[model samples]
Target: MPPQSEVEPYAAIRRDARSGMSGRALERKYNVGRRTVVKAIASAWPQPRKKPPPRPSKLDPFKPVIDEILRKDLDAPRKQRNTVKRIFARLIDEHSMSDVS
Candidate 1:
C-alpha cells in the first residue's frame, strides 16, 4: 500500500484539477499517475453523493399526488371503480408519473 503522504498529494492534485486544471496538467505539476490524476479529479470535487439507506418513499415529493389519486379510486363506487392498472395509467397519462420500481 502507498504511504499516507502520497495519498494526500493526490487529494490536493484532485482539488486543483476540479478548479479547471486538467488531469495532465495536474500530473505534470504533481508528478503522479494520469490515472491517479483522474482519480484525484473525481475525488476532489463536491458531488451529489448518494444518501445512505435512502429516505423512505412515503416522504418523497410525489407521495401526496400518489396518495390523493389512490384515495379517490378507493372511495369510488364498486360498480365504477378503478383497478390498480387503471389508476397507474391515469397517473401516467394525467400526472406524467412513474413508479421507481
Candidate 2:
C-alpha cells in the first residue's frame, strides 16, 4: 500500500479531472501516472486491489512424493494406514529429503 501522502492527492486529481480537465493536463498538474490520470477521469472512486496471503507449507515441496506414498497405501492392509510421522519417515528414507521441520 502507498502512503496516504501520495494517495490523498488522488481525490483532488479526480475532482479536477471530473470538471473537464484533460488527461494530459491532469498528468502534468498532479505529476501522477498517465494511467492514474485516465482512471481519475473515468471514475471518481479509487479501488486498489488487496493482495492475498501466500501459503507455503513444509509439505508443499514434497506433494508428489506424499501423493504417491498415500496412493500406494490405499492398497495396503488395514493395519498399514499411513500416518504423518510415517509419511515424513518414508520421505526421509526414499528421497533423502531432510529439508522439512
Candidate 3:
C-alpha cells in the first residue's frame, strides 16, 4: 500500500479543488508545486516512488565466503558461532578484506 503521507495530501488537494480552490491556492495551502497540484487534481492517488537499481557493494565478492561461514556456524555450538565483530575480524584476517569498512 502507498504510505498515508503521500495519500493524505492528494486527498486533501482533490477535496479542496472540488470545493473551488484555485490551483495556485492549493499549491500554497499544501506547500507543493504547480505540477503536484495538477497531478493531485487529475488523480486521487499519487504515483509510487521509483525504486533505484541495485548497485555493487564493496563486499559483493566476499559474500560467498561470509555465507559459507554463516552456514558452517549453524552446526557449531551457539556460544562459539560468529558474531558481527568476529565476522568482520575473519573478513580482515582470513579473507584480507581491507577496502570495506
Candidate 4:
C-alpha cells in the first residue's frame, strides 16, 4: 500500500504541474512515471478504503458477559485487570461456557 506521505506529494506535484508545468516536466521534476502523474492529477485525496462487514465471531454468544467483565475491570488496578486468558477462564468457569479449545 502507498503511504499517505507519498500520496500527499503526488497531489502537490499534480497541483504544481496543473499550475503551468507540462506532463513531461512534472514527471522529470517528481521522478515519477507519466501514468503515476496522470493518476495523481486525477485525484487529490486518497480514495476511501472499502472494507467488508465483520463476520460473526465464535465468541459472539458471550459478548454481553464479556462486556460486563471488561466494565468491572475498569475500576480495578491495572495489574489486576483481566487478560484474554483470564476472561476466557472466567467465561468457562463462571458461566459454564464450553466448546472453545
Candidate 5:
C-alpha cells in the first residue's frame, strides 16, 4: 500500500483516542512522538513548518553590471554577443569580481 499523508495519521489518532486509547498507546500505535499525540488531540490539522528568511547572494552587487552587459549585447550580432564564459571573464578582469566563481 502507498504511504499515508501527514494529515491522515492525525485524524486516525484523534478518532482512536476518542474511543478511550491512552496517550502512550496512541504514540506506539501511530509510531509518532508524545508531543505529536498531544498535538493531534489539540487540533485536527498539523501546524505548518516554519521557513527561514531569505539571504542575500554574492551576485547581488554585480546584478546591474551583468544586466548592462546583456542590454548592450542585444545590439550586437549573435556571434559577437556576450556568452556566459565571456561574461565571467569580464567580471573577473574588468569588475574585479574574483570572490564569485
Candidate 6:
C-alpha cells in the first residue's frame, strides 16, 4: 500500500474534483494519480445517507455532571482526576446505575 500521508491527500483531491472540477484538471493540479482522482470524485459525487445516532452508554447519563467535575478539577493533579473505578463508584452510589456492561 502507499504510505498513509500520500493516500489521505489523494482522497482530498478526489473529493474536491467530485464537487465540481474535472478529473484530468484535478490530477494536474494536485499531482495525484488519475485513478485516485476518479475514485474520490465518484464517492463524493453521490449524496451520503444520514446515519442514526448511536445509543448512549450507561455513563452518558452522567456526562453533564462529569463535565462539571472536569471543569472544576482542571488545575488539579493528574492522579486526582477521575478514574474508571471512581466513575463506576459514582454511578453506583449517586446515580444508582447497575453494572450494565
- Give the top-scoring candidate (TM-score): 5
Question: What does the lDDT come to for candidate 3?
Answer: 0.92
- Per-candidate TM equals 0.35, 0.45, 0.62, 0.43, 0.82, 0.39
Give lDDT tens digits, candidate 4, residues 1-101.
95557678777887897699998998888888888788788878656668999987778889999999999999999999999999999899998888876
lDDT of 6 by residue, 1-101 (tens): 85665556656785676588877888888886777676666564434458999977877777787787778678889878887677667767887787665
Report the number of backbone clashes for model 1. 1
Q: Which stretches in model 2 have alpha-carbon errors above 4 Å?
A: 1-46, 52-58
Could you tell me how far off, in angstroms, the CA of residue 43 lies in candidate 5 after the best superposition? Answer: 0.4
Provide the global lDDT of candidate 4 against the true structure: 0.85
- Looking at model 2, residue 85 earns an lDDT score of 90
Ranking by TM-score: 5, 3, 2, 4, 6, 1
- State the local distance difference test value for candidate 2: 0.80
Pairs with backbone N, CA or C atoms under 3 Å apart (clashes), candidate 2: none
Worst 10 residues of 3 by lDDT: 1-10
The lDDT for every candidate, in the order shown, is: 0.70, 0.80, 0.92, 0.85, 0.94, 0.72
- In candidate 4 the C-alpha lDDT for residue 21 amounts to 90
lDDT of each residue in 21-60, candidate 1, tens digit only: 8767888888777777766666654344577895587337
lDDT of 5 by residue, 1-77 (tens): 99988799999999999999999999999899999999999999999999999999999989999999999999999
> Model 2, 20: alpha-carbon shift in Å?
24
Candidate 3 lDDT, tens digit per residue, 1-101? 85568889999999999999999999999899999999998888898899999999999999999999999999999998999999999999998898788
**lDDT for 88 (candidate 4):** 93
Error of 1 at 43 (Å): 33
Order of all candidates by lDDT, from best down to worst? 5, 3, 4, 2, 6, 1
Clashing pairs in 6: none
Which portions of model 1 miss their true places by more than 4 Å? 1-52, 55-59, 98-101
